[model samples]
Target: MHAATTVSLIPVLSDNYVFVLHGGGSGAAVVDPAVAEPVIAWLEERGLELEAILHTHHHNDHIGGTPGLLQRWPQAAVIASAADRERIPLQTQGVQGGDRLTLLGRHLRVVEVPGHTRHHIAYVLEPQAEEAAELFCGDTLFAGGCGRLFEGTPEQMLSSLQSLSALGTSTRVWCAHEYTEGNLRWAAEREPGNSAIAERLAAVQQQRREGQPTIPSSIGVELATNLFVRAQDAAALRQLRGHKDLWRG
Candidate 1:
């Protein structure tokens, strides 16, 4: 049987994702922690002590909580990409792209999704029989839009997104940032007649209004709607990114 999982999103700042993953009942691992107070409170109340942290990149919002969290759980290991350990100095375990790590009883396949940032990484969690594949991708692949080319080229971003697209169709895409509603809006505007984007936008709007997360979007959903993921090549992705940067809405 698939190992039970609990993925809870603790929203911090404006649009950051602090994903807390609990296995069955007790041990938990947090991904991209921004702030620690709320995360500490939520976990403590649930009797979940911090066991490990998975950092996708070295952005302040992503790694800032590491110090604070370590103060609480002095032994919890911090896992991040080994290539950029200087930037992500808080990490205890530096991993590479092909690393297969076992965290809280689940196997996490590390995939280097370096586009948004040169050394950005994503974790693909695969449980045993009957479990679903889950992707904890940091800002690289948003709902409809992709992250700005901050440190990498469009070619890298396009290739990265394509790699993510090749994951299991049922893979739950847990992307950081609450940009889905705005992304869908932008996508609909770009392709006004595209019914798939329009429908997804309508559904996303309802979820936002209800304060419900529109995330854990399946690979299938993104393949059908995410513009960046479907871009023909890096040039096309670059052109779209340029246009999106200019597009006010």
Candidate 2:
């Protein structure tokens, strides 16, 4: 059996998270690094060396730190969407959906999830031994919300979300932002009678009060409490997205 891959969350910028993955070795890989100093520091503290950098889209926050990280480890492989080469010029191994790659002994499958950007993608680490599969979903799917329709339509976004929702229920979702509390609060407001949303909101709020992260939410949790995931169709998802975009609290 393959050694279990371990993931560490490095909170950066205002609400973004940079995920570092490794398999008990000095070699490590990071996903969607919004900034470099903290990530570099975190890895150095653990005596880890960056081996690869993965990008989900061309957003400044997602790729801004790549140059800095590359400066530290010039040989590190920079992986991103081939269609976005012009936008993400630093990528060394441009990939597309259905492609697979191995890193730190873990096999990762690329999933195209365009909505936040025209070529957004996600990485899913196949399950090994006792470890549940992990999903580094960038901004495509969140704990209680999904990315806005920045470069794609509602239908595309809905399709993208559904594809992610199809992952194994035990899969751990490591979204790139810390928007869980706010998303759940809005969900509760949208559905005032939903006990699932209400309960989840309360729990998330408490977690924030204690200065804790509500990330790495499971597919099961999102399937049960995320309004976007529960949306019946594209029309329903569009309506919910509009409401969420205008939500103030």
Score every model by TM-score: 0.97, 0.98
Q: In angstroms, how far off is 32's CA in candidate 2?
A: 0.3
| Model 1 lDDT per residue over 1-249, tens place | 435886888988998889999977578899999988888998999999889999999999888888999999999999999999999998899998889998887789999998899999999988566767989999899878888889999999998998899996788999989999988898898899999999999999999999988887988999999899889988899999998888887
Off by over 4 Å in 1: 1-3
Report lDDT (Cα) of residue 201, candidate 2: 91
Best by lDDT: 2
Best prediction by TM-score: 2
How high is the CA lDDT of each candidate model? 0.90, 0.92
Per candidate, the number of residue pairs that clash is 0, 0
Report the Cα lDDT for residue 218, model 1. Answer: 82
- Give model 1's TM-score versus the native structure: 0.97
Residue pairs with clashing backbones, model 2: none
